[model samples]
Target: MSRPRPGAGAALLFDMDGLLLDTERPVFEVFVEEARALGLEDAESFGLSMVGLSSSICQRLLRDYLPAEIGLERFRERWDAGVRARLAGGIPLKPGVAEVLERLTGAGWSMVVVTSTRTVTARSHLGEAGLLDHFLDVVGGDAVPANKPDPAPYLIGAERAGAHSRDCLAFEDSDAGVASALAAGCEVHQIPDIRPPDRPVPQRGQAVHRTLTDAVAAAGLLV
Candidate 1:
């Protein structure tokens, strides 16, 4: 893929869970506990499998590991209840999140959050983290027919930002997200979550960074 033009109207797109917010850890911990309660000993690995998936996709993926006695809907209800309880107080922002947002904001770049979370839930979590006001708009999983790894969400995100996909820099923490952004023609900077992808995601406009700060710098939007 070609580089974005210097004078183009550039936008900064971000993933929510493991990328900008630290909710994945607490959520996955709850998932493991729930899985173990259902007599699944290898719950940790099962929880890890859900890392970057949307709720819909996750339900499908989780069905393989869940017993028939514990159906997908019931499992989701239990996981939701547990995660909500654990995050009743507030969600933590990932390291360098505030600084990176501030830097990009000060530099006058348009910003949008393109996440695999549901619209209502994603908005609530962003509000709780005190980061909702930074984004010009949010494109959640429910907002698009197809989610990450399908590119529909990111494609819609660019449209929402009123910019071409190639004019955006998407910050992600999962291979699925990287693939989504790349497929949408956005330059993607991946900062892996707990477990990084074993192999490179084969796509255009893709790069990996150790941290959010590095991603911002690489995008040339550092203030």
Candidate 2:
């Protein structure tokens, strides 16, 4: 795999869930509990499939398993309320995240957070983490007409950062995000969470890293 350096004027983009925040496991636990309550036996698998996708997309993905009486809108509201209560404490940051962010900021890279989380939730989470100041802007899941696995979100992120997509380094933790960033023409690094991608990698111009620390190291950001 080729290790790309962040040269002058290069930008950085990040995915929120699972990648920067340690929210996936706990959030998925809530998902499982909700699904079981709704009498869906494949809750675990369903939860896994929803990783890295926006709530809107997850709703569609889960439509088939939803009980007809409950309906999509009501199911979403109840599930969101459950997850929100569970996450009321705070979202935890991934290991070495602050160090990497500090180093990258010191090196003068413009940064943006491009996430599949809705704008309201994304803002709340980042503000709670005190990480909002680290980014120049945020492109939320609702900001684009399409979500991950589509290039729109990442493309918009690059545009908002005022950098060409090819000059940006996108960090993500799932195959969906990887595909999005790659399609947008960024040099992407995937740091797997929960499990490795079912698809083979390098994934065109993207590379897989063991962790965010490894990604920062390879990017030579500490220099």
Candidate 3:
């Protein structure tokens, strides 16, 4: 596909959720509600940990919390409901998303969204944010075998975006998302949202920024 003359960036990639929109707050709020309903708020978030992890993995990670009285089936139902509620409420795009996306796309940066949520939900946020058309393709959370920290999502997204991994830039938040992008050979820019650093994320090879605009600027998406 013919694209504009890429100014400074070769290609621009982004992760959904915390990277694209302020999704975690609503998600966590729903989780809290579910936990309150199930009486496992603290334990559930501990298991549901990061944004880019698969629900299956998340469910298994919290298996320890499943009492013999509370089976996995019920846990799954309630958790899915909570997630559905969060999605139903919709989410907001992070500040500077539209400016940076427009800037990068105009500069011929072939941008794609590689996310860990289902395509429907990913599309919802992008559409809601008016950023859906910015991406050439989207790799959803359910599209890959393993989610972030595994490299599949990023690799697949790179392939779909017609970008070589080495020639692409990944914008992400969360440790898992950073690791996945780095592992896929993209230079990663990590914007950690409001997540406090309790443990080191994969920042050794990453450009760390506080916001999408800063990361996009640092990645050469803006002049």
Candidate 4:
């Protein structure tokens, strides 16, 4: 994908879990483990379907999938606990995250995180990953009326960065995230992680790359 030169002061919006932090696989493992502990036979499939979704939506889906006796709250408690235990040490950063952030910072681009994770949790994870300082703000799942694939989160993220959505460039690692950014009118580049982009090919000039490094490099940001 060729780079399009964004106007001066154009913002950079990012997705957190799989895009910036390598937390998706570990978290999905915890989800599968918790589900199987409850004797759910299709745990892996269900867990995969929840990728890039908001907590509320995931909870609602869990409610439908789990036996009434198990209860969503009880399942969430166990699943969240497992996630915490699994990530207790620290979240890992994806390759070239720090370098890209540093390069973008030097280039004077404003940056914001637009993630499906809750505000507090996203903040904490970014801090743990040593990436909190690079962003001007975070727009979490709970902060917007709707999550990814709806465009509200990215719209809010661009607003927080004090730029119009059309002026922002978004980096994402999921189909839902790419859709959100594209719908919000941002130039999007995706680096798929954990799961491939199952949705139809991106429209509006969006491109998918193998890694965050390749995405940014193609955008001419990593001179």
The best candidate in terms of lDDT: 4
Give candidate 2's error at residue 44 in angstroms: 1.2
lDDT of 1 by residue, 22-134 (tens): 98888888998888888887787777767778988887878887887878888889988998898887798889998878766766678899999998989988988888888
Between 1 and 3, whose lDDT is larger?
Answer: 1
Point out where model 1 deviates above 4 Å. Answer: 1-7, 196-205
Rank the candidate models, highest lDDT first: 4, 2, 1, 3
Give candidate 3's error at residue 116 in angstroms.
0.7
What lDDT does model 3 reach?
0.75
Question: Candidate 3 on 91-141: residue-level lDDT in tens?
Answer: 677888778888777766778899878888788778877899988888887
Put the candidates in TM-score order, highest first. 4, 2, 1, 3
Give the top-scoring candidate (TM-score): 4
- For residue 25, give model 2's deviation from the true position in Å: 1.8
TM-score of each: 0.89, 0.90, 0.84, 0.91
Clashing pairs in 4: none
Which candidate do you rate higher for lDDT, 2 or 3? Answer: 2
Clashes of 3: 1
Indicate the residue-level lDDT of 95 in model 1. Answer: 90
Check candidate 3 and list the clashing pairs: 116-141
